[model samples]
Target: MNEITSHQCNLNIWAHLPDKVWNRVANIYELMPGWIGYIDGIPHWFGQEEDDVYIQASVEPSGLSFYAQMNQSDWDSWIGAFKLEATKVLGFEVGEPEDGFE
Candidate 1:
């Protein structure tokens, strides 16, 4: 998780993204003051910079699951909006995004 940095916030959010990607992005996400979320039920964290990007996977899980990465330029508010949308899609009580990148 130490590979993420201010420069690598624009990570891939799909299931096929390479493991090295999250391994790098998570470092920055871990260091930043951001939030924790579940994109399509996969755990994720926002990256450095305001509305920078959200990285939604890691190397530990090994194989792929579902992921929903947004465009780096997309409004964070839009991503924030996904919680409610995802809940409806996922049919679970998708909780408010948690602020955990403390």
Candidate 2:
């Protein structure tokens, strides 16, 4: 997809992330049966089942990860503010990784 950025560096960026936003997404949370995976060497804190799944907002430009397929109702409950809180904690904003460097 045009949104997902490729992590060309050689490091696990998610591992270095603070437990502020996507640690669960980095270590757990299943998007689908065999659709989740751990990605290495890049920004965005997520893994995927494969390179073909176009899940939204699953990866972060900061190399942290998130889930795009949470229960819709559950996600609706706090996903927005949760993002705000998490971003506030990180002193950064979450967006598609196309504007600049990590």
Number of the top candidate by lDDT? Answer: 1
lDDT of 1 by residue, 1-102 (tens): 323222222212333546664454344344433457545545565642244455554333222222334553343444445444443443343332232210
RMSD of each: 13.7, 9.3
lDDT of each: 0.39, 0.39
Worst 10 residues of 1 by lDDT: 3-12
Cα misplacement distance, residue 97 of candidate 2 (Å): 3.0
How many clashes in candidate 2? 8
TM-score of 1: 0.25
Error of 1 at 91 (Å): 1.1
Model 2: runs farther than 4 Å from truth?
A: 1-62, 98-102
